[model samples]
Target: MSSSLVVQDLGFAWPDGDRVFDSLSFTVGPGRTGLVGLNGSGKSTLLRLIAGVLRPASGTVHTAGSLGYLRQDLTLDTQMPVDELLGIADTRRALQAIERGETDVAHFTAVGDDWDVDERARAVLDRLGLTHVDLDRRIGQVSGGEAILLGLAAQLVRRPEVLLLDEPTNNLDRAARTRLYEAVAAWPGVLLVVSHDRALLELVDQIAELRDGEIRFFGGGFSDYEAAVEAEQETAERLVRVAEADVRRQRRELIDARTKLDRRVRYGQKMNDTKREPKIVMGNRKRAAQVSAGKHKTMHQEKLEQARERLVEAEEAVREDDTIRVDLPATEVPAGRTVLTVHARLAHVGHQVDLLVRGPERIGLVGANGAGKSTLLRTVTGELAPAEGSVDAAVPLRYLPQRLDLLDDRLTIVENVARVAPDATPNQIRSRLARFLFRGTRADQVAGTLSGGERFRATLAALLLAEPAPQLLLLDEPTNNLDLTSVRQLSQALEAYRGALVVASHDEPFLESIGITRRVTLPT
Candidate 1:
């Protein structure tokens, strides 16, 4: 059978009674499909269900052929050898045994017809930019980016008919991303990927957006999907305006009809009181008038109800793109003020760096996976002392680490922000948190319970809302693991910041979106 994946009437819910999907269904043929959604919209869960990593509550997932899956978290035993991770260690051992003249049928069975498994594994590794990675090396010895690549390499070596990748480009640098992109572009199977990386999304043949408990397939890549959505929103907004006008017109007409009926009744009563016509004739006229008025009122009421329904439907069509909006005048530094200075060798990479930041300058810190970009950011924030130099900051600064560990997991979102801004009242903190899209009771959610996107927003809110205000900000891979919307929200939040910024990131598009003033690359 041709490679295909089909899901029929899929239903899933968490054990906590949180329903994620109900009767969701979609099919994938042999081509690249990029799955996208908001942070908790069940994209990952859907992929897991399809891959059989998680059992579905209901419905059936059918695959035509073999399947390979690369999960986002990529948890693995650090002590495992690279060959084992690549899934060729046993085959290689079997092949070696046969070469040693062992007359063992089990060894031949293990080897099968794949005597060149090691060579194929090495080729796949090399294709993903892991040429230097030895098969016998421990997984712990590789960088995080390399480990992600290795997982992909392992999947590619299996040559499955269907492949599912979730957030494959999370920690990959530009070069590694390029290599992965090439691999994705060349895949000849039913490939479905869940990712927030715009570049990776652009490589897909089509876009599948999971939203509001449903999946919507759009022709072409991310750009095409965006254009279609923009057009749809425009039409929806126009319809909403038309519906509102119709409702208003109906209301006015209803009021006019009521006024006319009241005037007619009063005129007829005055005439009857003056004995202008017989009592029976006047009574009959009054009853007929009452019936006419009721019909007119009911007609107008039905028209108004219909108009209101249309308005609601039109409004629903328009998507809500909530973004961060804030004004941080307190964080503004003087035009010529020295915000930060660092003159020392980075501890991890032993790279010499001399940097001076002034005013509200924005700097993008970029390097390979093991180039110590995080180390340099820590040194700038005084979190880690420089190996051979002194660091100075003229004003208060805040750091947002890659792991988003700044917030206290036990504390509520409001409490976390309040911890940083001690002088601000609970109400004051909540009012500001609203600008970060945490309104009402949402601010009361514990940090530990928040999704990846929520935690990023909460951490950012706390960082910017701190006491005395931060005049400088240091962010390490701030866009890592964030959804596309959250990344855009982060950019929106940073746009309002007046402080000097030193951001370490592998996401070049994000750095550009946030308007980086200059780029500094650390040596490997």
Candidate 2:
């Protein structure tokens, strides 16, 4: 059967009167579509509305055939058996009861048309690269990446015609991500996904961008969408230039008209003073000249105003996603300079990690979700003592942890930076903060009310702008929830910082974007 999803005249608002979307309409046909947007552009909210997880204030969602949805934050029961996670525990139990000589009608009813359910579950799990995970095992025994795969298997077992996935690659490792990507490529049904992972988005058939409470669809993958946007922006900028030129021409014309009116006024006054004609004739000529002058002045003024309005409209059509700019001389590291060393035995990473970081080298820590990456970072930062061995840093160090809990929520953005850099005056701090896109009153707003991207920027500003600038920076899963543009912005900011960087992440494209020079792999 043909499958599709449609949204019509959708409107939603928060209880605090913050309008998220209004009069939005879009459609998803039987193909893979990737949704892209900025942090607060309501991508996730739109998915929720279609998945029936959230109620809309107005309008409706229509879907043909059965539907399935996988949200970013899946609530898993650790104690539940693997069979339960695959959504086949009841059918398996009925088969067991029948094998034990039970002749109850309820057993037959439970096993109706699904006598082969157990075999199908095993096959699906194997296909999703979970061959080692047995149906009898508990969910707690497997790693996080395996758990996410199991979630996908559960949705596939139902064979729904329409599927919605939100950030499905958030915690998957590289190898596991490849398995999920393969599954997405083979899905022969309507699929819609929201993700920042470039590799995953590359597999989609089309791209849907949600911005300013509207949906715009582009043909092909991420690269195609980027090309289309660049072309559109170039056209918009050209229009702005044309409108600016028109405004200048109108201003010049208005000035020339004013000058001509002044000269005519003097000539009329001179004719009256010299009595060049009869008194009535001179009076009539003077009144006519004044009326004509008023009309000409009004026409030129109106034309200038209209030209300026067109310029404003043309400029508004262009988008400006500002980037950060900072110069930290103290953060630079000389070539061949020793930076840090780690010789520790982590709890999950069995092998003892002994390595040296020098100069401005970038290191990427790659591993599965439960492979002790965060633990190693904490150990390196002295937040958690290593189970064994030693770690040392020769330069100033700062760690941007996975949770980004470094800032004080009650304090304003400027105050938060000030707390970290006590020597810098408020004016100096504000001036530096503006480079991170926290200018004017935005810097004075309390940190508790910031959106995800804003909070990330504020945290980054506090870390980079602190006194005694850090020469070695550590980041954990920095691109987990950031939009693609924000990820690019982060890469740009890091490009300006001449310091050693150690990042722990599952995003391969982002890791490549930051120029990783070395790799550290942990055992699964």
Candidate 3:
């Protein structure tokens, strides 16, 4: 049977009654489709609903064939073996039992036909660049990137007709990402992936964007989708300009019409006061003039109203590009100042390095998965002590880890920022938070309640807005799960920072955008 997935009139809402989608509908046939949207746009939710992990409040999801789903956050037992994760442990056990001459009917039933699950699982793993992973090895022994690949391998091993992947490349390094991209490119089944990885999206057959409770399909890859959106925005902006001009013209015409009506009224009053005609004739002329003036005023008013409405409609068509706008002058360092110095052997990679950061230099840390980039950042933050060597910072330092655990979940965004900037008043903290896009009531939202992008913004705001001000900042895979817009926002925020920066990320585009002065690579 051919693979097909369809959704009709889907409606969903959170338990708190916040609606995400209402009467939403879309379809996915055979081929790879990239799902793109801003954070909290219901992409993940829609995937979960289609995967049957979450039930929709209304509407139906239909699948024509078997399905496999890989969630963004994998919850697995650390002690579970690789075979168990691959969902072949039972079959493997049954095969072993049959080999031992334990010809039980139950064992045969468990083994089923085509008893080569082990080899198939191994092949899938190897294809995903996990050739070193042993069937007996535990999940905790592998790196985060390896674990993500393993999750994908598990789905591939199942040979499902339809596969749903949500942010599958979040923790993958460049090499791992390349392998995943190749796999995605080769997928023959119906595949729907929710991701912010540009390279991965580039491999898709089409792009499906979820926005404002609707799905928009764009042909070809990410570049095509981007060009299409750009053209649309350009047209929308042009229409806005046209609408504004129309509104202005209408307003001027309305004013002129009122002025003419006023003049006519004054002239008629003067003529009546002068007794230029008989009383009956003057009365008829006054009523006729009043009626004509009212009609003229009403016609201009309607035109002005129509123009204003068109202006509103045109403005709404333009997308909002809310960005971080702030100045962190406190983070500035003198050209000759040493912001950070480190001489040590990285804990995980055992590489010796002597590094120095001066002034407002930006450094990009580039390496494959398990190459100790994260370890180096942690060591710099003093969270993890180096096995051998000294590290020093001449000014206040801050670190934004990949986990983004800096914020206190129970506190509001305002309170979280205030925690780091204790000297700042509530109003002062809120004012700064607004620049992070958490304005007014949004600033009062609890950190735990924020979406992924919101939480990242709040955490970044807290770190940058700290009382002492960070002169040296360390970031580990900062753009891992950020949507494209959020990534831009992050770059915008960093552009205003005058501090020395050390960022470890696999996203080369992001690194370039943030103005990296140099790059340091750690060997695996």
Kindly report which residue pairs in candidate 1 clash with one another: none
The lDDT for every candidate, in the order shown, is 0.92, 0.90, 0.91
After superposition, the stretches of candidate 2 with alpha carbons farther than 4 Å from their true spots are 101-106, 347-350
**If scored against the real structure, what TM-score would every candidate get?**
0.94, 0.95, 0.90
Runs in model 1 lying further than 4 Å from the true structure: 103-105, 408-415, 423-431, 439-451
lDDT of 3 by residue, 70-95 (tens): 99988778899999999999999999
For candidate 2, the lDDT comes to 0.90
- Candidate 3 stretches with Cα past 4 Å from truth are 97-113, 334-337, 345-353, 368-371, 408-435, 438-450
* lDDT tens readout by residue for model 2, 1-524: 48999899999998899999898988899889999999999988888989999999999899998989998888899999999887889989999999999999999999999999978998889898899998999999988778888999999998899999999998888888998999999999899999999999999999999989999999999999999999998999999999999999999999999999999889989988998889999889889989999999999999999999998998888887577888888899998999999988875456577879999999999877778888888888898887788999999999998788999999999999998899999999999988999889999999999988899899999998877899999999999888888888888888888889999999999999889998988776
Q: Candidate 3: deviation at residue 69, Å?
A: 0.4
Candidate 1 residue-wise lDDT, 1-524, digit = tens: 89999999999999999999899888999999999988999988988999998998999999999999999999989999999998889999989899999979999999998988888898999899899999999999998899999999989988999999999999898899999999999999999999988889998999999999999999898989899988999999999999999999999998998999899989988988899898999999999998998998899899999999999999999887577999999999888899988889988689888889999999999889888888888888778887897888889999998888889999999999989999999999999999999999999999999988898899999999998899999998888888888998999999999999999988888899999999998878
Each model's number of backbone clashes?
Answer: 0, 0, 0
Ranking by lDDT: 1, 3, 2
Best by lDDT: 1
